[model samples]
Target: MGKSQKKRQMRRHNPVRVPDSHLPKGLEAASSSSSRKEAILPILQKMESVDPAERKWACVAVSNLIQNDPSTRRLLQGKNAVGALINRLSDSEEEVVVEAAGSLRNLCIDGGFDICAEMYNKNILTPLKSFIPKISTTLSEYLENPKTAPENAQKLVYEFADNVITILWCLSETSNKAMNAINQISLVPFLMSFLASRERLPISTVTSAAQCLYVLTDENPPAIEEVRSNAPYSACVLSIVQSREGLPQANGKNKEVADNRGLALQVLCCGILRNVSPIPPPSVAATVDVDRDIVMPTLEPVLSLISLVEASQHAQEHIAKEDAIPALEKLSLKHTPKSDHKTPSGLELERLEHKLRTVQLALEILTGVCATLPEPDFDVQDADGEATDADGDEAHEDEDMDDEPEVDMAPDNEAAVKQQSGSNATIFQTLVAPLLTLIQPTPLSFPPLNGPSPHPPTTSALSAIHVSALECLNNIFLSFRGAKIDAPRADPDSGRRIWDSVWQALGAVGTDIDNPGQERRRATWEIGVGVLWGVAEAHVKVLMQLCDAATDEGVKVKCIGTLECLAQHPGSVDANRVCTYFSQRVPEPLLQAVSALIDIYSDETLPYDTNFRQGRFLDALVGSVEGVRKAVRGIDRKKERELRVRGEEVRDNLVAFIEYRRSLGV
Candidate 1:
């Protein structure tokens, strides 16, 4: 009671001193201010008798005071104030510089713009111009000999750059000379160097640079043109171009390598995507997100990287080819701005569609070129008119280049092993043919998430490629309408024995068989899907093959599992196509079996591969019932009405399934 009474008395006597917004936005900002303007002005004028602590608070008070009231605009007219700020920009006190910048920003408001303009007009730009080169040289020296880089240097660089960018951005429209002066400082070089550093620069710095440039270029073209012509801006552009080629090499870890590669792709995408002048497919285009202010010209160099993949594929450099594909996909992955976290829409979709079309075209080119390679071909090119990896890597066993047909379907018994070795002779015969034919290596990593770290951690590329390939595959599968892809089929001449053999081979590889001499077993799974999406002239037959394999005891269960997972791909065959398959390939017994499975296993863990289809089938069943009402409109009204009632029953059943699963936490 005594402690509570004391606290109540204290609350009655004192309350918060400042209005909420009048308080500085941050810890340092608050600490840098005076308790009052009268107290603040005294500190601003002090040349002596001040502790660093008092000086820090004085800086905050000054910045906050100016921000809170326009009367402080006259501070610029006071030579002492402007000089103090400029000096404090180089202050040993971090708070001092932050506060100085804040105050300066306020001072430069229209009433205060004249004060800064007067300095620039009277040759203040000269000091900034002279000072920047020294700063740049110092920063460069630190980069070259990092030991020489000062403590808090990144902060210094950011402040210095922000000041210059803001000034130029604000003044670019005033006169050509003002713009020219801005260009002479070579701010672009400094900013680019910041960007190129593997070390993460502060977001504040990057943001300031981006905003300043967007304002300068978009609002005042002549200023931007001048800046571009200057050595600094040109150097920045060149650094960006070189960075694409400097993708970090993978270490032994495939996953880590994939991740690092993804980072490279992100940089490239961010760099190139701004130049999205080309168009995209409408539905595909619907997914693009556009918000950042990066302009088209800036995107040009990045787009060139995609062409590099095509060129490398032509040249036969496997590593290069691999790099280019993943890189392109990464760049095309959805990019958004930090200022706003929202998906792309409207015109942005059109822009995305255009970008996607280019990617699609590139995929076609890559697949076609890869498919045309000599049986054991590498996807990269070397400058010296020499080829390597065409015979496959010497580290691995090689097969003769002739005499083979579809995969070996039988188990890898000694005879099956011998058959596989024989088939390997047809090195060009695998499913890589179609994948290499239709899909472009994705350059985008994951969909847009967080931005890069202080340094891009090294293990991102492999994950990027795998995920991108999956997404692209999903999209490609979805794109499969009823149209037949012009792919080669198993020979009808062999009474479909070749067709059966090929599938057997597919099943064989998908099994857990030991093939010590196999070049790649995943090759089997990849090729099957490639044919399904790209060259399936007989969609109904393939559907039957997949269904039979899933149910048949003779086929290994894992093969069925693989097909089940593949079906989840977004681009996997469309739901409409599912109906077509249901009509043609789904037999009455199988439909009944599927329906039975749902009823019996409503709350159980479905068979490994069957889970996906099970859920889909339930939904399909519901749709089928809905179709009853429409079908009975003109004829068979009584049956239509009956089916409509039955449809409601099916829908109700599905609701129960969902509720049941929710209860079990499945």
Candidate 2:
């Protein structure tokens, strides 16, 4: 009795521990602690349970565990959790299928190429595709009794459809292989159908469908062509862009949700347009007539939205500036200014950012179309009055160059149609006008230091609005560079105005300084320099101003670099016009700025290494100074003398700095 009692007590006190060898192959490696593995292994096992209820619960648990946590997701992947999930996608219980799909969707978030490749190899799309018809059927049935259908049922259907499309989106984004696989399944038409029937689908489904299309078509020419080939796709996109049925209200209680939904739809539409109308310079040679017709209608809504956002932002700033109490009045009447008057609401900022993105996408579409259009051809005649080819061949020699059937060098019919549609006018009024307004300086002065700053600045770094605007402006100028147009008499002034805004935006009150916190300033400076460089001939004055007025070393260096680029390579700018402008307008300020830069480099008091800084700033400066020296040699002998003298001084200073550094073994 004593031996039996002792044995029984010992057994009760020490429970048996399972060995790692007995567990699934990779389960032990999923987590560091044995106890954690023990906890998770049961759920993994239960996922394979014969009972559908247990499997459904397991799927939900796994889904939640991996939803937002990357480490847990990686661990699950290591444990072969994907194979289990894929198996459950075909589960007879609808709940299990939905949960498994949700789980897979979460895993695909930022999953990287390897995980996505594995999922693709597992034929994840087959199960995902299978769920579409099932969800569609359920949705159709639910629409019959929309008011009476249970909320859970509606949520389940929407979530399921969202998950399926989201998984497909992630897969398509992973690599070319996955995209091709998706393309083979006719995914574009599938998603386009969902987008077109927005009345029947939930907002979530419609958004996901659009997002899926966006991913599928992005940089995928064949997929884009597929979408372009679909007869109803462009109309569907235009419909979504124009629809106001479910738009966000300004003061609504669910403003954030409504705003997000609107933004999603807009972004999706823009993305489709962007892909279908490829941006230029890596020109898409294969033309799609569908995209040609879509350019203006797609832009109409986007540009209008941008104008509204710009107006609202202006109004908000106006209110913030005007609402302040004067300092003397505050002392006399003992009134305090409202603290909350300056900060914009989160929803307002989100809406503005969304609109900025739409504007960027719209500009991208315009840029693409402009790229597709033929450049204005100019005939070159020899001094002897004989026409020559680009290679300097005589007209008869050009005929011998390519004997293949002479392809029409004339502008395509699409270009003629675009002109007839007055797209250029619409673009100038809609896109260029509003963008110029954004960069234009306001009349309000900065308030006194003791008072709050008038026009409170946005707290965001590198605001999407400013960046997108700058990028769009750059693309417009670049695309139109050298292209002849029959634009109105004011068009040349429009170009000058663009230059004025760019200069003002780049060198505005807060931007000239070198503050790390002022990230937007840097972005503005970079993009502004790019735009000016694009239209260097027209903006020669702006370039001169940048070289003279810029105080930041980086800005100084970049401006010099841009001048060098202009002088060395005029790009699409008329070389004769550039030479004329530089000869007439740029020599004096350009030399002054260069002389100042030499003095700055020669200064010995600064703590930084001159040699190190020189490496960064000298090449561009030398190139620019020398370029100016060469350009004005004959036209302006006096200016040429001044440039040579300043340039020699800079070169001597730079050489002296290098020699001194080397002597010190620095």
lDDT of 2 by residue, 439-534 (tens): 433332222223222222222211434544566666555444434432322466777677677787666535443442233456566766777665
Error of 1 at 344 (Å): 30
Runs of candidate 1 exceeding 4 Å displacement: 1-37, 47-57, 71-80, 83-102, 109-123, 147-157, 173-177, 198-200, 218-666
Q: What does the lDDT read for residue 123 in candidate 1?
A: 53
lDDT of 1 by residue, 1-666 (tens): 000011111110001111122233443444344333343446565412245555555454444343323223343234356566556656666555555555554444322234456546555464455556765776677667766656677556556556655555555444556766676655555555555553455544554454344334433445444444454443443344334443322221222221222323333333222222122323221133321122122222222323323422322332222221111112211331111111333223222322332333223222222222223113222222233232212233346634666686566566754553443223223323232322222222111122211111101221222222223332232222222221233333332433444454455334432332121234334544454443333333454465665655334233333333333333322221233334222223222323333344453432221332333544445445444334324335375676455444544565565456446533
The 10 consecutive residues of candidate 2 with the worst lDDT sum are 10-19
What C-alpha lDDT does candidate 2 achieve relative to the native structure? 0.53
TM-score of each: 0.29, 0.54
Best by lDDT: 2
- After the best TM-score superposition of candidate 1, give how far the Cα of residue 503 lies from its true spot, in angstroms: 64
